[model samples]
Target: MGNIIQLSKSSPTSEWIDMSNQGTDCFLELLIMAANDLEKTNHQEKLISFLKDQKDINDIAPGTAGFKLDEMPWCDETLIDDASFLICVTKEAQSESVLSKLPYKVNTEIVFPWLKQFAVLIELMITASER
Candidate 1:
């Protein structure tokens, strides 16, 4: 069993996101929920689109993720290093200082759990920003 990540707005209602394939959408949703709108810049938009593309392809063929982590035409992010099942890449997103770089891999199995924690990070950043 995987861990549970809970989230809710200003209501009595709540949602529990399981930290696994079932919560893939939650990760993608969290990317969208990020406070800075990456879509505003054409380059940033491409990065966002690339993220969706990689995730979709990953859901279909998990092994193909390694090849997809190459140089992006729209952004300066690049693969800094890699191993048999992992790829480390440059981080270019605007974020809270807790992180100096973006997650350096394309595997959903890895990303989902990391994203669960990232969701909390984003929520805290957003909540703090609004205050």
Candidate 2:
């Protein structure tokens, strides 16, 4: 069976989002999209660097090096807070995917109200970058 990553705003809450099915590919796509936006704004260096780091992390063998969200740098504070939320969620999802390989299920819970705000933040960043 494929990995499953479930996220909730907090414990005791009835609402939980399942991001496992989408897998890390979805997160990578969004990051690439964000990186593309950064590139259009003359942030080529940051884009290249971030992509390289992502690739390096992905290439590492499992149980050798763990994924870290804070390692990814932010060029602008405009979306830093929101982007950080997305990054953390993505990291947790990726970690859970690996942990799911064992005979156990991984369910992650995040305390932030990121689900509803994530879409808005992405839109805002995209719109702002277009200017």
Candidate 3:
């Protein structure tokens, strides 16, 4: 995961002054950094670049264990079941055909773990926002 998602903001380039990440809002912090990176790169940067500003991931992220994105709007049955989101993402990452559609190179080793961690946060927000 050290290729892109592992590039720590603190240890990397000292030339570009990184904005403070000490804010209490974890979600807001991500949005702010995304906006900052977008502006600096003329809005042409890959998602991986934004990932570099995050803390290095040294271990595997936990799989789906709570609220599911594929099951939103509980009254209606319109989404995939629990864990299917993770399965689809992993499938796409592993597919050579899907890889061609991406703007950046796909390193399955780096991506799968990132997806797991990302999926959890998404589920958390969905659960919170829906409440």
Candidate 4:
């Protein structure tokens, strides 16, 4: 089974921070870089296809195909929004057979750390943008 990574904010009442124009632009650039990396490795397509197939076989409610790589939130984003997306994707992926597969099982370990780093970056950017 793939390792499931869950991210949670320590406080729910934290003030929401908006990303500065520069920070938003930088986030878009970073997101593109990440998306390109996934595409180059074919992981993006594999994930999409896996989700689609799983939905089909399981008779899962339609529209559970998960988010496209581009549809994922950028770094200058809210924790609640990002966390919700992550939770949804994780649950769908875990319910599918793909989680136990080779690359996915391996990728889980590799990807989660990067995601955590990205989350940290988001928090930092939010703080920086506030000043």
Steric clashes per prediction: 0, 0, 0, 0
Clashes of 3: 0
Clashing pairs in 3: none
Name the lDDT of candidate 4.
Answer: 0.35
TM-score of 4: 0.26
Query: If scored against the real structure, what TM-score would every candidate get?
Result: 0.33, 0.30, 0.28, 0.26
The C-alpha RMSD of each candidate to the native structure, in angstroms, is: 15.4, 11.5, 15.0, 16.2
lDDT of 3 at 75: 20
What C-alpha lDDT, on a 0 to 100 scale, does residue 8 get in candidate 2? 22
lDDT of 3 by residue, 7-112 (tens): 1233234222222222112222333233332233212232223333332221122211122222322222322232233334434444455455545564555444
Comparing 3 and 4 on lDDT, the stronger one: 4
- Itemize residue pairs with steric clashes in candidate 1: none
Q: Candidate 2: global Cα-lDDT?
A: 0.37
Residue 103 accuracy (lDDT) in model 4: 32
Between candidates 1 and 4, the one scoring higher on lDDT is 1
In candidate 1, position 28 carries an lDDT of 48
lDDT of 4 at 113: 42
lDDT of 1 by residue, 10-128 (tens): 21213333444434533443454342332244554555565566457547754343221223333323211111001111121223321323343344455545554434433443354
Query: Local distance difference test, per candidate?
Result: 0.38, 0.37, 0.33, 0.35
Per-residue lDDT, model 3, residue 45, is 31
